[model samples]
Target: MAGRGGTQGKSGDEVVERGGERDAGGGGMEGWKRKGKRSPDSSLRHVFPTPSAFPLFLHMAGSEYGRTARDVLVACLALWSVTSLVVIAVWRTSPGVRSMERCKAELHRARGRLEEARAEWGRRREELQDLLRKSAQNQTHLRRQADQLTQSLRNSDASVSRCLQGRLTYSISRYLVF
Candidate 1:
């Protein structure tokens, strides 16, 4: 088994071998080997470098930390889903929503009633105007009749005064003659 830490060259073609059991053919490094039947100390050993540390660390951490992280993420997602459902349920049953619906219904009914009242008022106004017009016409007719009656009375009074004056003059002349 190789130790955990190791160094790599800049070109990624070299690796410092760590503490590990060397194979009989002397593999180049833990998971790398030189090609062909080359000596263990040959420079050809550096042709292919060992694997990098970051991929190894990820492989190692995936066993424990990855599971815990996945569990926590799943739990958080579930909690968020449940909380959203609860909020939706509460909002649906809230009194304010119901009150708003009722108020809307009442407002609709009130508007309808107001429209009816306005229509009725319009009809009543038209009827009152018609009555006023008829009353005005009747008043004009009555005034004309009254004027005619007054003229007839004045003519009768003049005729009656003329007849009485003629009778009085005749009686006086007869008494003077006697």
Candidate 2:
């Protein structure tokens, strides 16, 4: 039974492999045949087309008929002058230019204010740190004073107990004698 199953699997794989190969070859060859039939004529027609009127006009304009180099320089200078005048006019009349100037002024003021604020904050922070250090020193000093007071109170309590015990012993001796 195992041998029969192996043979069936091999036959199924062969059939699928053959079908895939046929499909791939048919698609590739059909595209190639269609492109090969149209490419040569189309490429030749586009590459060798006759010149039109617009191209002729462009050629005439680019050619120097009788104009001197000085004339060309003068023409270029005039064009540049006109272009600069137009640009200056636009800049002076445009609202965006004025808005940009206002924004720059406002930005400068904001930067000045920010610097002032940062300086003030630094000063305040230093003051706070100094106060904190002083507070810590005061706390330490108070703690030391409290410890000294506690020690003195303990010594005084010990002395008072000794005096009381001595008085009690003296009284008991006198009574026993009587």
| Highest lDDT model number | 1
Q: For residues 73-166, could you state the per-residue lDDT of candidate 2 as single tens digits?
A: 7799999999999999999979999999899999999999999999999999999999999999999999999999999888888888898888
- Model 2 has an lDDT value of 0.58
Candidate 2: clashing pairs of residues? none
List the candidate 1 regions with Cα displacement exceeding 4 Å.
Answer: 1-62, 166-178
- TM of each candidate vs. truth: 0.57, 0.46
lDDT of 2 at 9: 26
- Cα RMSD of predicted structure 2: 28.9
Best by TM-score: 1
Output the lDDT of residue 172, model 2: 95
lDDT of residue 137 for candidate 1 = 100
Expressed as tens digits, the lDDT of each residue in 46-133 for candidate 1 is 5435557433433333334544775788799999999999999999889999999999999999999999999999999999999999
